[model samples]
Target: MSEHAAVDQEASNARRGRGASGGAAARRAARSGGGPGTQLTYIKRKINVYEVLDEEGLALIE
Candidate 1:
């Protein structure tokens, strides 16, 4: 293959890992209502809000 084609192939492997198979496991989890628990979930795992627990009194989470 051409140099550009070889480089593109390597980049794609790096992006998706060598044998990821296009996220079949994740799709199965979503379809069957199966997945890790809330704390283990990554969809909402990022801490976006910086709430003050001492001033807000923990009610913001509840």
Candidate 2:
């Protein structure tokens, strides 16, 4: 194989390896809530909610 072809193959393999491992690591981080020391804080709403349904409409659904 040519030097260029070999380099391309190596890069492709590296990308494939990174993608496989990165996916599992990403899932783990997501499940772990970004590891220890990360505080879960409530995000305050910037905009007020627009109430579309009235009390009667809500009561009928309930």
Candidate 3:
């Protein structure tokens, strides 16, 4: 690939690693739903917002 393509690919990959996906995975335990005792009854193991708690160490001011 050209130098520009290589740089773009690398930057994209790095962004993904440090972007929302990474955060989601790291905080999956808190955001995931479909666990036992939760309101979700369709899927016991399904991950949803209900199971997520606002404890990602980062929050919006507004």
lDDT against the true structure, each candidate: 0.73, 0.84, 0.64
What is the TM-score of each predicted model, taking all chains together?
Answer: 0.29, 0.27, 0.30
Residue-wise C-alpha lDDT for candidate 3, range 1-62, written one tens digit per residue: 69999999989988776465445555785676525564545746655556344655336533
What local lDDT does model 1 show for residue 56?
66
Model 3 residue 39 CA deviation (Å) reads 15
Q: Order the candidate numbers by TM-score, best to worst.
A: 3, 1, 2
RMSD of 3: 25.1
Judge candidate 2 against the unseen true structure and give its global Cα lDDT, from 0 to 1: 0.84
Better of 2 and 3 by lDDT: 2
Put down candidate 2 lDDT per residue, 1-62, tens digits, no spaces: 69999999989988786565567778889888885875789998899889999999999999
Q: After superposing candidate 1, which stretches have Cα over 4 Å from the reference?
A: 21-62
Give lDDT for model 3: 0.64
Q: Which model, 1 or 2, shows the larger lDDT?
A: 2
Collision pairs in model 2 = none
Angstrom error of the Cα, residue 8, model 3: value is 0.8
**What tens digits encode model 1's per-residue C-alpha lDDT throughout 9-60?**
9898888764745487877877887855566445656567775576567667
Ranking by lDDT: 2, 1, 3
